[model samples]
Target: MLRGFTPPYTPDGRSSLVPAPPWHYAGTVLSMACPTEPAAAARFLPQGFGRATGRIIAHVCEWQATTDGWELLDPVNAQYREFILLVEAERDGAAVNFCPMIWVDQDISLIRGWLQGWPKKLGQVWMTRSYGLDHPAAAPLRAGTRMGASLAVKDRRLAEAAVTLDGGEGQSLGFLAGPTYGLVGAPSIIGEPTAGALRLVLPGITGRVAGPMASGTAELRFFDAPRDELAALRPTGPAVAAIGNVAITVTGATDMGVVAG
Candidate 1:
């Protein structure tokens, strides 16, 4: 029902959709290797606590491009541009793990590009270099939460509808979850909101993160397995909506649009 999407998905527990994303499927990943500075990101968006850091995040997305299944080149281009800007933010993790997942909505080619293009690290896990899908650290998922989905958007309006799970309610004009998605589908290991309200960051991933206190989610629907449209909403229990998927703060684009009327 989303304006341009059906549903989303995540990777199987088996790691079948691999060699590209998260490199490996790490469910309920449970190992804490804190970053060098928990607040290093503060410098990028330095301001009072209220100031929103305009740093963009680069992520790989894959899937069809249009409603009639045509091709939405403009939107796809917009999405890709935003991703590149995110890479410019410069986030280096003393240890950034690869927890690959599959969502149903995005395109696979684009997702691969996001991973291949972004900055990555290879460190000694237990005693081996964790690079090219061979990170040597293996911590049993100490504690993780996940959900499965199998539903679809019958109503165009509901497909892209985003409802606040809690705090972000009422403030939004309508139940529209995101500009393009309805926030449904695959449960993510990481929960950074994207794909409209349906896309988001996973709490389990956040809880185990030991980095500069910065935040992001896997955008699971973008990587969910059996990549195709017509996916369903496999439900995860209760959680936060992806409040900041496409953070738009246009301070300079105004000049591009002149008085045409």
Candidate 2:
């Protein structure tokens, strides 16, 4: 039987409610700066935070990992896709990514994300790569190699994009490092017969970019989902789209405070 601080195990013993184990990711990422409706975006911002300096950015990527915690060889946690809608926001005069929506297919990921206030949900995600047999292994981001991904819920597709990393400049991951804010609603400890309290969670993780694609063109399709926060991503002009491999570690989280009513 599972004991200690490990999350409860399933009756079938197939899965558990534990966070993802430390892992490495090798994949391609596409980022674009898009136009955002200030009013609509503000709805996702937490208290004491304001809009960021630049336009909102959208990130779509597909990743294959050694493992997400149960075990290194576990197939269930080895691969997944991610779609992130990030807006620039300021907290205490510090810039950060105000992640409004993030979708993944794994359950453990969902739990861990919620614990950190990532607003993560389960969704169908996919990415594809085009390569030839003679392609040089040393240069994974070869010219003419194309990649694309889509984020969908049920039968509805919310976002889709395809890009070819023909050429681009090198970029540092430092530009991407900043505070990430998430909002989570949990049962009130006071036990009052009222709506559960919402808390803003900030998780701390260490990661770095491994590869870089300086420039690329992306064909994107975004739909409106009135009930979903992803609808806030409105790309006005295409920003520099790049490709890269990243490694990240999920350390822990910090609870900021309960949202004032």
Most accurate candidate by lDDT: 2
Error of 1 at 2 (Å): 40
Q: Candidate 1 — what's its lDDT?
A: 0.21
Candidate 1 per-residue lDDT over residues 74-93, each given as its tens digit? 55422211111120122232
Off by over 4 Å in 2: 1-15, 19-27, 65-70, 130-145, 170-175, 188-195, 207-209
lDDT of 1 at 167: 23
The TM-score, computed over Cα atoms with residue i paired to residue i, of candidate 2 is 0.79
Give the root-mean-square deviation of each candidate in angstroms: 20.9, 4.0
Q: For candidate 2, write residues 1-261 as lDDT tens digits.
A: 444224565445444555344544556666655556666666667666676555566677666555444345666666667777777776677767777788888776677667777788888887664333656443356666666778898677888877666655735322255677777777654766655888877776666556545556666667877566575566555554566666666566778788752
TM-score of each: 0.20, 0.79
